[model samples]
Target chain A: MEINGVTIEDTFAEAFKMWGSRLIITAATEQWAMTTAQAATGFGTSIIGCGCEAGIGRVLGVDQTPDGRPGVEVLFFTTSKKSIAPVLLVRVGQCIMTAPTSACFNGLAAEKTVAVGGKLRYFGDGFQSSKLIDGRRFWRVPVMDGEFVIEEEFGMQKSVGGGNFLILAESQTAALEASEQAVAAMRQVPDIIMPFPGGIVRSGSKTSSIYKGMTASTNTAYCPTIRQQVESVLPEGVNSVMEIVIDGLTEGAIAEAMRYGIAAACQPGVVRISAGNYGGTLGQFQFHLKQIMA
Target chain B: MGSQLNSEKTTAVSINDDGVTLRLKAPITLPVEAESICPDCFVGCQQSEILALPVFCGRRRKMLGDIFSVSGEASDRITVEGDLTHFKRIGQGMSRGRLTLRGDGGMHIGAYMKGGEICVEGNTRDWTGAHMTGGMIRIRGNAGHFTGAAYPGEIRGVNRGTIIVHGDVGNETGARMRRGLIVVEGHTGECTGAGMIAGSVFVFGKLGARAGAGNKRGSIVALGETAPMLPTYQYQCRAQFGFLGVYLRQIRKWGIAVSDDLLKGSFRRFSGDVTALNKGEILIHD
Candidate 1:
């Protein structure tokens, strides 16, 4: 299949089952809300080194928030349901709670939930107070500027992670531009986040590594410079490759994002679009590129 | 001032067309213990059985049919109509279903209620929702004192639930409340939230004198005028409270009007009832 004359590979992207939580951070202004959300999701790109994967999902207007303030939605993903609490403890306590005019609320509604504000209330020492409204509990912890309000529990659910698509272009500039367009398009899809800087990963990896204790290494087959040194997957005209990794609350969300992204990335100078997979052996979910574009 | 707060009287004999309704035959002067009026009591019972439910009229045993004319089929939803000013414990210990009282009700309207909803279209007397563990009670008109308060010997009052009084309330509202919320849109009588343990009482009208007198860890928010604080209370600070915005927005859904200034306003905090744990706070809108 082809989209705008760009080849759509028959390969699929393998995604693993993960636990995820959505947080709605609201502040006095939209700027403060984005500031706090960005801070809480900082240093979070891949669970392998960041302990979790996180990104800002979207910006919300005042009418959409619980507190009637401008807000931002953030998504956090962890390998296990049990690991999500500790990750939230650190990010919310060290980042969101420290920001000015910010308050955090659970954006998801699920039966399974973990305590975030219930544990963070200790920061108030003996001054913390809780309010139960409409069957939802919220904690008020006294801070230096004012009180930091957060929901007592944050809902968690099974999520999909590592859903990726690679953009193969004729040059470095073409690959970079296509990746940017794809990232911008994917950002419009709800419940999904591209967990990479500018939603583009230049260093796509393979499962095998040459160095000891390194589980992953660079994908030499896609390296244009190494075409003569190894059996490269790149065609004669292909010179650059950039990947966009997606994490979403559901498999369908990831597929929806990938469809929008791939269609947007099929611009001039793009050679083809493909996905990374381990021969369909590891991840629980797989998104076929041609099927998605179709 | 008292006439201004009277809610529009609902004259419908049956508030819910599909539910069982009990219409009083005539006005009564003597207090009647009518805990059987609760929807939980009528659940699964036939229409005849509901009419035969036992009640106490001034220490005399009587059937519910003796005082009121029962109608409709058996269901978990019940509607009571007419002058109920002398009926007590109207929905005591009810755990599920809905109960609607169309006129004034007597004391202990929802005492020990565990779940479901009770809507009082008119005024309610003292001890309403005493020791309630769950559910919600919305009083459209004035309420007598001890609303959401504990029994004389119990440690907690309205442990879990919500009580919203749209009109004024008599003294000691939410007294000894351990948990839950109580919102009064009009002025409260003196000593409101006195001896509160842990709960929230938001009064949009004038806060009565000596409020939160012995509160240990509760919050009393005064959005309008407030009476003079007691000597046991100490000024804390004047700062914006983020949590109040959340509470205000939630309450607005229940037909309570909220102004933009109050939704994004600052409050003067006073930590007190130092004579007790001194952890309770009174926040007056600034």
Candidate 2:
């Protein structure tokens, strides 16, 4: 199947189960809130090296927040539930708490929760206090500017990670432009985040590498410069490729993002749309490219 | 003060209903014990049975039917109408359901309440929501002293729940409260939050004299005029607190008017009641 003269690969994208949590970071202003959110979710591109995959989900209005402040929603995904607590503790305590006039709140409502603020309350140094509003507990830790208010616990749930689509284009500019357009469209969907820089990954990796101790290596087959040195998967005219990876609270959300992203990427000079997988041997979920578009 | 009802009747009244209503038959001059008027008591009984429930009027034992006209089937929601200034214990120990008082309530209206919601359309006397553990109590008018407070000799009061008073309250509101939130939109009598163990009392109007006296780790926030602090309390600092905005915004959601200035304003913090834990704070809006 194809659209806009771009071939839609019959292959599916393999995704694994992950544990995810969402945080609502708010500050004195929208710019500050976005700044804090960016700082908190920064350096989180892939769980393999960064310990988690995180990105800003959306910007929020005052009416949409718990404290009636301009805010941003950020999502974090870890490979295991047990690791989510430590990852959040470091990110929220080091990143969010250090930001000016910022407060972090749990954005998800799940039965399973991890204590983030409860542990951070120690920063108050015997002056910490708590308030229980509508059965939800929030901690107030005194800070130099004022106080950092955060919910006592953050909810976590099983999620989906590594839902991606590849943009194969005839030129480097074409691939980059199509990838940017796809990322912009996919970002509009809720409960999902494209974890790579600018929501596009230029270095798409394979499951293994020739170098020792390397869990992942470059996808040589799709690399334009190394096409002659490797078994190239690109068609005759294809010269550049970029991938957009998605992580979301649910499988359906990932699929929805991928559908919008693929359609947006299939533009001028794009040769084909494909997905990377381990031949369907790994990952609990598989998103068939043609089936998703259908 | 939480009371358990007959198991069989508890099951009977658990069914959903349109709402049971009780109307006073005539004006009374003496205080009446109407604890049986609670939704838990009327849940399983028919209108006739509800009227047959016993009540103590002054020194006389009387049937509820003799004092008021009860209508509707057993249900979780109850409506009481009349001048209930003499009626006491109207919603004592109730664990569930909605109870609305169209008229003024006497003492102990929602003492020991565990769940559900109680909306008092008129004023209420002292001991409103005393010892309540859960649920919400909204008084649209002024409330007498000891609102959300512990009964004398009780160790804790209103451990969990919320009490919102739209008008001025008598002295010692939220006294000895262990936990929960109490918001008074108008001026308060003297000694508000006195002997508070742990809780929060927000007075939007003038705070009474000697507020937060003997407080043991609690917060008394005065958003309007504040009286002079006692010698036991010491000056802390003047700054903005993030938690206050959260609480104020939540109060606004409950239909209470909250100004933008108050929502974004800073407060002068005074850590006091040094005579006790010395950890309690009185925040005067700056």
Candidate 3:
């Protein structure tokens, strides 16, 4: 399937079921909200090593937030239920709590709620008070500046991870530009996030590595693009290949993001567009390149 | 709230109301010895969580099957269908599920609600939703003193959740509420939002004295009033806060009738309680 002279690899991206939570962080200003969300989602690229994958889902308008403040929606995914609590405590505590005039809330309200504020409220050292409004609980912990409000518990639900695509361009600049545009487009869509440092993943790993005690192998197929020639080679005229990874509340959202991302990558000097699929993890539904175009 | 039952010899049956009463007909005798029982103790009689409750009843801290027969499903819902005039702690520290009282209930319909909904079809006594973290409460009829207010030693009333009363309430409505929205369709007693750090109280009817004393950022909407409010408040002219409209509309869908005047009314913003904390402000109707 060729789209605008760019080959859409007849392959699929492999993904796995993950436990996910959406964290809504509100701050005094848009900048603080974005900064806190970005920082919280940073370094979370792949669950392979980072233990989680996350991204900023959207830049929320003040009117849409619970506190009438600018906010950002962040999506974080982990392999297990137990793995989720630590990520929440560390990320929310360090990033959001550190940010000025910021408050955090759980985006998902599900059957079972986990304790986020219950764990973090101790930062106030018995100075925290809780309020239940509309059947949801919120805790107000006294902070140095004023007070930090967070939901007493967060809802957790099943999510998907590792929905990814590669951006292939003639020059590194073009690849970077296309990747940036694609990320911007995906950011507009809700319930999905790109957890990489900057929504761009330069390192694409195989299921496992050849090295001892290693679990991930580099995708040598898209090298040169990297340096030093290896067994697999990059297509000619392909100066760079950057991957866009996605983690969302649902598989449909991740698939939707890939559609937009691949379309955005089909610009000048682009050689091909493909996905890192795990042979046929997608069941019952497949997002075809031709279908996406139509 | 009253329900007819045929069970006899049901030991330690407790009806949480004005009195934690346990009564047995002369035909049946309860077996539990020592009293001062937790509600959980009654469940052990049949090893079930269903405890019959009324608004007010006679009790023996050291008593057995004080009032009525206890029977049926020990489900998440605990329903009482009697003349619960003296019910106390109708729902004490209920961590989950629904608790419904068919008739008027006495003090503390829901003291500490962690989750779920509690509906009082009839009027209720005081201290409702005290220190609650989650869930909702709707009192179809009037309520007595401290509806959604704090206990004496405590400084705040309801910690979280929403409380909607269809009728009038006694003194200290939502006293020291840290957060949450309390809507009273009828008149409210004095000291509403007293020492409140944050939260909102909407009284469609008249509000008595000192509605917002020491409030940090909470709002009290008196659609009809005798605003003998504290002098600490410096009135900041009337202006409509859009959230009030949204909130009123939300309650409307939930079956709480909040008059149109409240949604479209101009509110007087009083930024004070500076005596205790400068952060608090009282948003009152102009």
Candidate 4:
């Protein structure tokens, strides 16, 4: 399949089940809310090194927030349910709690809960108090800037991670521009996060590494420099490839994200669009490139 | 507010006002516990069966049918019309359904109630909503002492739920309350929120002397005039609270009147009851 002269590969993108939580962070102003949200989601590109994959989901209006302040919603995903709380505690404590005039609330209403402010309340040194408002519990920890209010618990749900597609172009600038356009378009889709820096990963990896101790290594088949040395998958004239990795709350969300991303990446100078998968050896969710593009 | 009740799904029980004033001719005493008259518990009971339910009236055991004329089909919505100033424990411990009272209610109204709603069109005596765990109690007239407060020997009061009073309340309102919200649109007597453990007390009218005395950890928002606080309270800076908007919007849904200025204004924060937990705060609008 092809669109706008960009070839759509027949392969599929593999994704695994992950535990996820949505957080609504509100502040006295939009800048502060975005500041805290961006910092909280930083250094969280992939579970391979960051222990989580997170990104800013969207900017929320004042009427949409619980506190009636300008806010930002973020999506954080981890490999298991047990890891979600610790990651959230660390991120919120260091990023949001330290921010000025900020409050954190649970964005999701799942049955399964993880302690977010329940454990962070200890920072108050026995002075922390709680308030139950409209059936939701909020912890008020006395801070230097008045108080830091956070929900007692956050809901966790099963999510899909690692939904991705590769953008191959004739030059490095072409690949970068196409990937930027794809990220911009994918950002419009909700409940999904492109965790990579600039929403593009230059060093896409295979299932495992050639070394004994390594779990994953770079994808040699799509390497422009090693095209003559390996069994390259790139079509002729394709000199650069960049992948857009997506992690979302559901399979439908990921598919929607890929649809927007792949369509936007099929711009000028883009040669082909392909997906990475383990040939059904790993992960549970599979997004076929043709089906998603179609 | 009584008009909100759907008469089609309600069982109307009218009090028989005889010339001799037929009070509960009871074999048991101490203001009868009429908790079983709720729609949730009286699901399949006929009007005759409901009137047969035992109740105590001034040291006497009597049938509800002996005092009131019970009519209408059985349902979760019930309307009681009468001058029930002598009746106690109306809608007590009811976990689900809706109860509406047309006239004055006696003491212990909605005590220990876990869920559902109770709308009183008239006044209520002391101990209203005591030890209530959930649901809402809305009184359109004056309420006696200890509204949303703990019982004499109990440690907590109105653990969960909301109590909205459209008129004045007696002393010690919301005393020892552990959770939930109590909004008084009229004046309140002395020591409002005294010894409050946790929860919120929002008074839209004047507050009597020594408000928030010995409060441990809670919010006492005085939109109207309030008496001087105890010296134990330390003054904090003034600032606008963001959570009040959410709280006001929620209560406004129940038809409570809230001013736009109070919703957008700043408050002078006073952390008080240093003799107790010292974490409670009084936010008086500036």
Candidate 5:
């Protein structure tokens, strides 16, 4: 299949089940909220190094927030439910709790809960107080600016992670440009986050590595420079490749994001749009490119 | 108090009269514990079974049928049309279903109720909603003292749920409440929210003297004129609280009155009672 003159590869994007939570960070102004959100999600592009993968879900208007301020919704994903609290404790305590005039609230409601402000309240050194409003509990921690209000707990839900699509182009610049456009398009969709720098990952990996001590390594077949030396999957004219990794609260959200990202990546000079998967192994979810495109 | 009931109605209980039909065949000469006459207990009872339920009239164990004339089949929704000023412990421990009281209610109305809802169209005696764990109690008329207050010797009052009083309430409203909300639309008697541990009390009318005297971590929001505060409460800065906007929007959905000024105005924050936990706050609208 082809869209916008770009060929659609007959591959599927493999996604694994993950534990995730959404947080709404509000501040005295939009700038502060965005700053705090960016800080909290920074260095959180991949769980391989960063304890979690996160990205800005959306920018919320005053009416959409609990605190009646300009806010940003962020989605955080971890490999397991047990890891969500520790990851959030570090992210929120260091980033949002330190930002000026910022407050945090749970963006989603689920049966399973993880401590967010409950564990961070100790920063108050026995001075923290809690308030219950409309059946939701909030912790007020004293800070230099007065008090930082954060919700006591956040709801965690079963999520999908590692939903990705590859943009294979005739040149590195063309691949980068198409990936950038795809990222920008995916950002407009809600409940999904591309947890990579500019939502583009150049170092897409395979399931296993040939090297003795490594679990995962680069996809050499897709590497433009090594394509001649190794088994190359790229069509004849394709020279460069980039991938957009997505983590979302639901399968539908990831599917929707993949659809939009692939459509946007099918631009001029782009040779094909493919996805990374291990022949339906090592992952529970599969998003077939043709089905999503159709 | 939580009262659970089956979702499907096996019976239907309704008041047979149009006005305040006296459910009781004769006026009670003594105070009776009418706790059994609630939606939780009558949801699946037949008229004969409802009358056969037990009640205590001043230490005398009497069958409910001997006192009141019940005719409707039992269901989840119960309506009592009568001068229930002699009835006590009505809707107590109710976890589900709806109970409607058409006339005056006696003391301990909805005490320890955990779920469901109680709507009282007439005045109620003291100790309304005492020790209630969940559910909602909406009193359309005046309430006697200790509305939503803790029972005697109990450490907490209403732990969860909401209580809305559209008319005046007597002394110590929300006293010792640990959680949940109490909103009084009219004047509240002296020492309102006294000894409160945590929770919120929103009084839209005149607040009585020494409000929130011994509060620990609760919020006493006085939208109207209030009496003098205790010396233990230290005056803090005035600011517009965003939580009030969220709270007002929620209570408005329940048909509670909210003025525009109260929703948009700044409040003078007073942190107290310093002699106690010193975490409670009194937010007087400025």
Candidate 6:
């Protein structure tokens, strides 16, 4: 099916089950909070290379934050539950803990909690103190500036990842602009993160590698370099393709974001819009492009 | 001093024993009525004057047999001494009962207890005296978090009650505590008196961070330094303040020995937690 001259590829995006956590960080000032949150979530674009995916969810005003200070919410997702703890320990220790006058809390209060601060509390040596407020536990580690308060644990939940859509354009510049608008529209969603390089992945992957041991294969359908040898699925004149992968706690949240992103990416300079699917060979969650668009 | 109830309606109880086990007769259930009697009525309950006494644990839907084991004597006051770590909703909504305990007691020590008293000689657990509209509790040792706080997910705490803790307390001490007085002779834990619309807490020892972090009204007199003073708090001038002595003296009734320097010393008044509504104040006295 096609609309607005952009062919809708009857393909799907294969994703795996991911575990994630959300941390609410606050600092003495809005800038520090934003910087610390951004840093902790930085360098995290995909579980393939970064071991995890993280990002700043939003900037909280003093009136809206837990400690009544300017704060930011961060989302982190991993391929496995076991992998999540280590990545979080290192991230929080190096980023949020090092930031001046910052405090962290579990943004997702799940039935089962994952110990984030509880594991990081050792950084306090022997001076760390803990308190129970409203049934939730929080730890205060003494710092040079004053103190760093963080929740003992953050909530954990199963999520979906690699929920993506690719934008095909005549030029690299056009592909980037469409991807940018799509990313902006996806920002309205919660409990999800765009874990692609610059929120856009130009190199999409296939299920298996031709040379055993390498799990991911290259995308031949949209590969302009292999247009002559392969039965290229790209419409004539298509030169570039960029994908946007999403990780989220719930399927609906990801679907909502995908819809907004596709609508934005379908703007000018975009030749076609399609998803990278594994022929329903992966997890149960599937995003039918037409159904979502409709 | 966690007490369970069994056939409380017909049971004869009087306590003057050195050691007795009043295990909560019920697990995961409301505390027995024996917990509701006044500190004074406890004398009658212990005196075997159950017929003449106007006291019991309180009113609940279950039977006393559902919660406790009463194998001790009938007397004027009973000493309950044992491991009471998991007890909860005890002495709730009590008005009068003279109960003595050598061990810790659980939440809601005297919930809405209008005219009674409960004395705990050891550490008391969280939610102690929570949402207590009235009554008095004298704790000889440290108390866990949320002492005199509102019920879980509730809006206000301890509309009126007198809670004296000889030892330190946890976060949100007297949280949302409205009209009442809480005196802590020892150090107080973090966020003491947070989100309190009214009330007062006089801490004699070192206090934890964010004391009175979100108070619309009430007074928190700090005798020692608390690290991590809330950024919301603004530093005011330091000067001699006699009111500090009065509060210290009031807690002296709880066996907290104090010197005169605290009451007659210079204090620093900083108003804040400006982060919220910016109404809380910390009076740091030297």
TM-scores for chain A, candidates in order? 0.99, 0.99, 0.91, 0.98, 0.98, 0.94
Could you tell me which 10 consecutive residues in candidate 1 chain A have the lowest summed lDDT?
Answer: A126-135
Q: What's the best-to-worst order under DockQ?
A: 2, 1, 4, 5, 3, 6
Docking band of candidate 3: incorrect
Could you say which candidate leads in TM-score?
Answer: 2
As a whole number from 0 to 100, the lDDT of residue B40 in candidate 6 is 34
Which residue runs of candidate 3 sit more than 4 Å off their true CA positions?
A207-218, A225-228, A277-294, B1-181, B185-187, B190-286
Whole-model Cα lDDT of every candidate shown, in order: 0.91, 0.91, 0.70, 0.86, 0.87, 0.72
lDDT tens per residue, model 6, B1-286: 2233323522555344442235544334333334433333333354233333322334535433334455444433445555454455556665544566667776656666564567888888787778877667888888889888886688778876688888888888988877677878788888898887766777877888877877765567787766677777788666543223334544553467765565345688776657655555677776
Q: DockQ (Cα-based) per candidate?
A: 0.65, 0.69, 0.10, 0.44, 0.37, 0.05
Error of 6 at A21 (Å): 0.6
lDDT of 3 at A166: 83
- In candidate 1, what are the lDDT values of residues B136-199, reduced to their tens digit? 9999999998999888887777798999999999999999999999999999999999999988
TM-score of chain B taken alone, every candidate: 0.93, 0.96, 0.76, 0.88, 0.91, 0.75
What is the full ranking by TM-score, best candidate first?
2, 1, 4, 5, 3, 6
Off by over 4 Å in 1: B1-17
Please, what are the lDDT tens digits per residue for candidate 1 over residues A164-228?
Answer: 99999999999999999999999999999888888889998888887999998889999998899
Q: Put down candidate 5 lDDT per residue, A176-213, tens digits, no spaces.
A: 99999899889888999999998999998875787897
Residues B1-286 of candidate 2 have per-residue lDDT tens digits of 1245434476654565799888889999798998887877777776777778889999999998999887787787999999999899988888889999998888998898888899999999999999999899999999999999988888788898999999999999999999999999999998999899988999998999999999988999999898878888998888888888788999999998899898888899998799999989999998
Q: How do the candidates rank by lDDT, highest first?
A: 2, 1, 5, 4, 6, 3
lDDT of 6 at B109: 64
Which portions of model 2 show Cα errors greater than 4 Å?
A: B1-3
> What shift in Å separates residue A42 of candidate 6 from its native position after superposition?
2.0
Off by over 4 Å in 4: B1-33, B71-74, B242-246
Q: Per model, how much of the real contact set is kept?
A: 0.69, 0.53, 0.11, 0.42, 0.31, 0.00
The top-ranked prediction according to DockQ is 2
lDDT for model 4: 0.86
